[model samples]
Target: MNSLSPDSKEKTQKRVWEYPVPIVKGDNPEQVDAYLTGTIDEPSYYNELCHVLGTAEEGHSVTLHINTPGGIVDTALMVAEAIENSKASVTANIYGTVASAGTVIALACDDLVTSRHVSFMIHNYSGGMQGKGHEMKARQKYTDAHLSSVFNYYYGGFLTEEEMERVIEGSDIWIGAEEVAKRWQDKLKKAEGSDNG
Candidate 1:
């Protein structure tokens, strides 16, 4: 009887294990259910990200490629937390643009790599409220406080306390790849050193 060839065995082994790529590319323009404009707000997005991180293959890094203009703060935070808690190394690649909450998610990665033209924006989170005048003001205040806490929680890790304060004070803070690289080099370097140690 003829024995199974090496190539046949390799193909069989390859079929046994399937590695998943969980990057979410927003729906295309021609797609019927497409909502490509603005930020992504699908709850499934957060769930999928968590699942990918949780099921990542051992000894391999997970690269989250992002190009988003930012979206719901809570969802972004959830995704960021999933990335932060992942056992595998998480690297974020800023392909085109990452603004607002997107920037926060990028910072949660163990390593951030960006292309030359990549840009990110940092700004306070804002949401609309529908209520009576008095209730509206109270709601707004509550929202502002929550946003502030998020800013402090996320930026505190990547930026100096003073730097974070400055960014928070701005109406909108935009940083290019070069500026981001310069500002976070020290933190990234330290992380690398600690990982090696």
Candidate 2:
């Protein structure tokens, strides 16, 4: 049975599972309708999303409505993994500004829904550092290698190799909703096909 862990329970007061309409204190639900809005830096959003997924079952469906400027690569990755590992059929309804790590969560969904007016963006990760020159250099090298793997894995098909390279080189790639639709058409289709099968 799908249920929230004790720690997750203590962190969230909302219920994703409510059986039989007016849910009482002890009810179980199989589906989750969640949202990923605002900045991803907030731990509450992560907790809520995890609470929903914790109750997901094989035939369950989870809809995540996304609207964000994106934040924290680590948090985004954690959210992405949560969505990816869910047993439910996951769909992401992306709207508003979807940039940086926001795209990661969007792409992790099994299906996507967005308007032609939505704004989409992709760029390299950015951060600050301070230390000895050599130490900073070593850190930069390690960070680049690690993020390169992350970028390539997440955006391999969404962007051409040239575009991906440019992104790594600190270029910000922005596309309109129509362009995003055109670019991700094949990937979405493949995802749909796999879900159907």
| Candidate closest to the true structure, highest TM-score | 2
**Candidate 1 local lDDT, 154-184, one digit each (tens):** 7754666776777657667778889877766
lDDT, candidates in the order shown: 0.69, 0.78
Clashing pairs in 1: none
Mark the regions of model 1 whose C-alpha exceeds 4 Å error after superposition.
1-38, 133-135, 157-163, 166-170, 189-197
**Please, what is the TM-score per model?**
0.70, 0.77
Candidate 2, position 5, lDDT = 96
Model 2 stretches with alpha carbons more than 4 Å out: 1-28, 42-44, 188-197
Clashing pairs in 2: none
lDDT of 2 at 84: 85
Worst 10 residues of 2 by lDDT: 17-26
- Tell me the tens digit of each residue's lDDT in model 2 across 165-184: 99999999998888877777
